[model samples]
Target: DLTPRQVTLRDRTTIATIVPFSSRYGVPPTLLQYLSDTMNKEIEGGDTYPMMDTMTTDAFATYWFQNFGAIMLLGTYASASAVTEGNDWATQCLGSFYIKPNYTGRSSHISNAGFLVTDSARNRGVGRLMGEAYLAWAPLLGYTYSVFNLVYETNVASCRIWDALGFKKIGRVPGCGNLKSYPDRLVDAIIYGRELGGPLDEQAGEERFDKIRFYLKYGTYPHGADRAEKSRLRSAATHYRLREDDVLMLKGREVVAEVERQWGIAREVHERGHGGINRTTTTIAEKFHWVRIKETVSDVIRNCKECKDKEAAKTAVVVPAKRKLDGAAEEYLAGSEAAPSPALRGEQEQMVGAEQNDEQFHVPASPPQADKTLTPHQMDGEPYYTSLEYSGQTPNAFQTEPHGDLAPVHLHADAALSLDPQIMGPMRDDFTLGYPQLHDSTGQPQFAEEAFHIGGHEVGRGRKWEG
Candidate 1:
């Protein structure tokens, strides 16, 4: 009834768990199959790990298991209930890494680990979780230091994770990997190392590095009486770095933001869009090593006049007033949507026939229709609707109804539908009644529109047209 510690997975939502799965106890068949499969896949791709002579599952077991070390797994499940006695959840493994001795008994305190993430689990931030777990697990496993002997430079994701976790790129081996993907070129590999944040960091922060940087600078040991103390300081100095900027970095990563520089560094990070305490602290800790950084960030954020103002603004009530605009011409109401300028409007228009004299008559140049009109009875089985073509200036208004025998007729220009008396028969022609059998249907105009668009415009309200 042992329950592994659960973590909220990379998605920041679902639950993931980490557990120790030792080779001695034997791995679950499915989980071992997955681990071996993932390693072989990485080898075949010839980019992540070095290309090996034999990529068989047996080779993977020997390489990843016993002869090297034991594995720690980060895994998740479909549901909480799926976590059971048989370890079914391990099939959903996010990633697995082996922790083993980097050297024989004397230097075994320094451990090495190889990390592999499942293809299904790439880019889920679980790689970082695996890295973080390595730091924690390695130390508890009695290892004081950790190292990765050959991380390919092309493995940007792995480099980024270790960099953020404060692992230093201490050495490089140029053109070492004859990878399958790069048949003609040899890819360079880097050596990365870091203190597992173990007993070495147990000493007070300043008390630890101030003397180390001094020796790396001056080659003089601390003015101490005891041999053990001198030797310890020298050992610590090897991992601590002194930069050209005179900023002491441990293992090539973190620049310890000293007591004096702590505020400025924290403030500098806070000024990068000013995230709240946890965010600001996380950002600062990613690059700079400050003592009590979370507390330092909290103090900085508390004193941040900017954050306080923003907090107040979030809670502040908004007061609004009714808006009114005054003008005979177009005007905007205060804070309301302004009318679009003329350039922003789209003119809706189509081609029309050439113009002619108001008093003249002529034939239309195309789609020649007989220059004639039809009475209601004459259009019994014809294909004529209202005449579309017109001569001269278009009419002001179309009369829908007329007096006497001229009641309810169509009217138009002389070209398309001539107004000549012979053409404009004393009866309606251009239009015919749907129910021509009714005697009273003559009074009802076939169709009429009070508002019409002419020459790409509607007759204006007051005057948006020719006066």
Candidate 2:
């Protein structure tokens, strides 16, 4: 009777094992040598000849020397408890998959692993156990994730095993593996990704908006200032003013300083002018007077009267003069006498009444005929005085002066001028009774004397003036 020996596998942390490949399976030296030769011939005849040649013992030793300070070879064994079978035993060689720290980024989320099983160990779950042990030990060795860069899609068993062990396909490359013997018939290399509890969650929209707001407020993106600085300033004007002192603390301090400089310029403009800069009634200085800064240094350009007049002329409207009292009605009232007369006592009464009426109800006399009908000279080209009247101790004493070329004069005296009824009754009266005449009907004035020239010679005067 024979008892089967239990098989156990464990990790070896150092390169102490030098187990020969043939000795592990209990084969004789000659048979093992023959097996090695046959395996070499098979490999040389296969498409993996270049790979097999490259993966020699010397190459493995060089790889270990270059990569790790030490290498560990693990094993699995099975034995039968019987001397009749001449200590019949089975052994499998195992190689470790080492991941050194700091090979990638400072983050320990990435790791590398490799696994190989001997032909005698096929279908015995050795490879699967090795892979599972690697996955389980990687986290304790400070790896956040394990990435498998190349896994052939045609290798369905391995793909299923890795997929079952919480790894997902992340990327792929085409024509990567030998696919002729596989059912998929295509070489689709896959990248398996396993997340080992790092930051991996979808960012909220509110968080994104907050980031945008921060950039807008500070005039900077995540890295540095951007063109949105001005827009941010315009949007948060109040906030900018409130944080004016903190402007230097902002990320885009230069942009804020530029805006502040422009603001100072605007303030200076307002300080120098009656109306503020911004062309607005309000100003930054006036609005934010609590700030301790003095007025800004700048000059305001003034608008002259001419400019004002030109601007006013654009929309000015001409208005007609309004009539006050009618001139024709006033004239009729001046000429009409209110009362009348009779015989002796009645005559006296009438005389007294007339005097009383003359004193109390006196009216303006009709304007002088000379003034009313006097023709103006077209040659003199002088403006005409409208009407002439006199008030004085003597009749028409105030009418002494002729009308001036530029303006009409009104004279004052103690006595009033009385118009003769006979002369006033006529429409064509020569009312220049006591006044000296200055001009004739032909529009030639007596004062039309010659103008003196140099050397006492008068060249053009005394000649008829041309219009």
Q: Against the true structure, whose lDDT is highest?
A: 1
- Among the numbered candidates, top TM-score falls to 1
Estimated TM-score per prediction? 0.39, 0.28
Q: What TM-score quantifies how close candidate 2 is to the native fold?
A: 0.28
As a TM-score, model 1 comes out at 0.39
Off by over 4 Å in 2: 1-53, 64-90, 94-96, 100-103, 107-109, 178-186, 197-467
User: Residue by residue across 232-331, what tens digits does model 1's lDDT show?
Assistant: 7778777777888767786556756344367678778998898988888888777777446785676567556688789899877443223333421123
Note the Cα lDDT for every prediction shown.
0.56, 0.36
lDDT of 2 by residue, 41-72 (tens): 43554322223443444334333223321111
Where does candidate 2 clash, by residue pair?
Answer: 392-415
Q: Which stretches of candidate 1 lie over 4 Å from their true place?
A: 1-3, 67-91, 198-467
